[model samples]
Target: MTDVFAGVRLLGPPETDGEYIALSEHETVHLHEYTRIYAVPGLYEHVVQERLRCTSPQVAAAGFLRAAATLGLEPDSMTVLDVGAGTGLVGELVRHGGVGRVVGVDALAAARAASLRDRPGVYAGYVVGDFLHADELREALRPYALGGLVSAGAFGGTHATPQALRNALAVLSSGAPVAFTIDERWMDASDPDGFGAAVEQLVADGRLDVLERTRFQHRVTTTGEPVFYQLVVGRTG
Candidate 1:
């Protein structure tokens, strides 16, 4: 693929809070400003996937497939809810992995538009709503009978919060699978995101039965350093 980001330059590693410079436009944008990134077709793929080498989508999909297999479930028999489904990257992977249906949920209209524009038909439906305030969305999703949930690269900093995760979990049927990946730091006990404590409580309270938790390099930073993320696969208890 041609380098769509040839005029874009990434500076600093993730640990140092990386920033990007668009040489052609002479503008600086944060690495996490996904709305702006998705506005330009192939810019996100070029910067995040090609340049930084993000692999969360593939890793999360594989984890979800493994968890489904462990539960004696076939992917084609499942409908999955994809939280933070940015540009349908994860949803496309899950759909190609044989999921019967994939519904995407993102707070940004730009994300939904980008998904439809780039990977048309990947998601059976895409809803724009805050997961924390999704009572109507929950009711609307009932018809899909979502059997699984997957989130990738959407659980830290200004992204989805632990409460959003809990809200997503509330919609899944008992025993339905859930898979997600987050930066390892965010999983640390002291992290302000509260994802670590929330996950622990879910497991302790028998709300989710964790099947696998693996730490892997989620991506390479702009400086070519590794950024690790933890992939957690589980089933609702």
Candidate 2:
């Protein structure tokens, strides 16, 4: 059987740092353009997962599960807040990992719509609001008593900013597990985004405790070059 997105074409290389393409009957868009991509069922998976082989969701979930296990936390008893939960991919994986409840947060309505269409019932609750400024969402999530935060492939580029991470942490209970994956370059000292510095300062200030850090292939670029990402699992202090 022919794939739904078999006609989609991606162009660009790892050096470009992002992929761009015009799918059949669609406008040209970048690979990280979640709103547009999610509007079309199977397109995001075909481009990012099937073609590029992105495994960030699995990597982040594995690290979180392992950390939770080491901390004597039962996955089936934990409620996790999935930041930047594009199309509910990470939420689905985390839920399957036995998390009792999964809440998804993203800035795009298209993402929420897509998640409902593609992975219905995966997230106990899905919020369509920016993590940085969505006070209502923060309040809505309060009822969930989130015990952990998990984000995959949503920290770098035009996705969630460092401040978004802080906002996400604010909603979780103290000492909750936090896990995420980002391009290694985002953590470089030279990167102007200051994500690395922000995280380091959080640790230095005793606000977060580092548990595990692993580097792995996040995916391959359209040019077939490997893109490396770092998975970080920690606990809010």
Candidate 3:
């Protein structure tokens, strides 16, 4: 197979993400450039998965299974929701992990398109709407009986907020398995409105019961520097 990354160049370190690939010799894009990145077929997979060696997808999928096992629950009848659902990478992983059904939710329509193009049939259904405030989105997802939630590289930074997490949990069945990964910097920050505080508040309020929290290298930066993120496993109250 030919190397797709051969045409790409490293621009430098991204602020928080572990990727920093250039479109051309002189044109670099931030990770937030989703439209540009997702527009190109195989670009995201090559840059983020192959080149950067991202592992959050696998980690989050495995974490979900671990959470289920810890809860003495089986996946035979569970339906999982993959938040972010970019290109269906995480969704595909969870599906192969034995989750009977996996629905995807992403705010970007382009993401949904890319997933269909690159990884068709991975998601039982893909919904594009805001998890935080889309009133109609809740109804749209209700048919899936969202009993489990899993995500990787879809929280923190310019991605899903902690409130989004809460809103998602609100619709899930009680004691639904939940697993996700967030950058360590975002997970440890003391900002009152940050994920750290939000999660603390969730656990304190008995909304989310955390089961396991561990840190690992999510991926490597353009300069080959390790970037760490925390995998959080829990269940809704």
Off by over 4 Å in 3: 14-20
Per-residue CA lDDT of model 1 for 1-237, tens digit only, reads 455556788776445566664536668788778788789887888888877889999999889988899999989988899988989889999888889899998889999999999999898889887777869779777668789999897776578788877888889989999899988888886764478888998888888999998899999877787999999999997
Writing each residue's lDDT as its tens digit, candidate 2 over 1-237 gives 136666777787446455786687656787767787888877787778778899998999888888798888998998898888888888988888899999898888999999999999999898888876858778878678889999997776677788877777778777888899988888875654667877887888887888987799999877788999989899998
Per-residue lDDT, model 3, residue 167, is 83
TM-score for all models, in order of appearance: 0.92, 0.92, 0.92
Ranking by lDDT: 3, 1, 2
Lowest summed lDDT window (length 10), candidate 3: 11-20
Where model 2 places Cα greater than 4 Å from the true spot, the runs are 13-18, 25-27, 190-193
lDDT of 3 at 125: 95
For model 1, the local distance difference test gives: 0.85
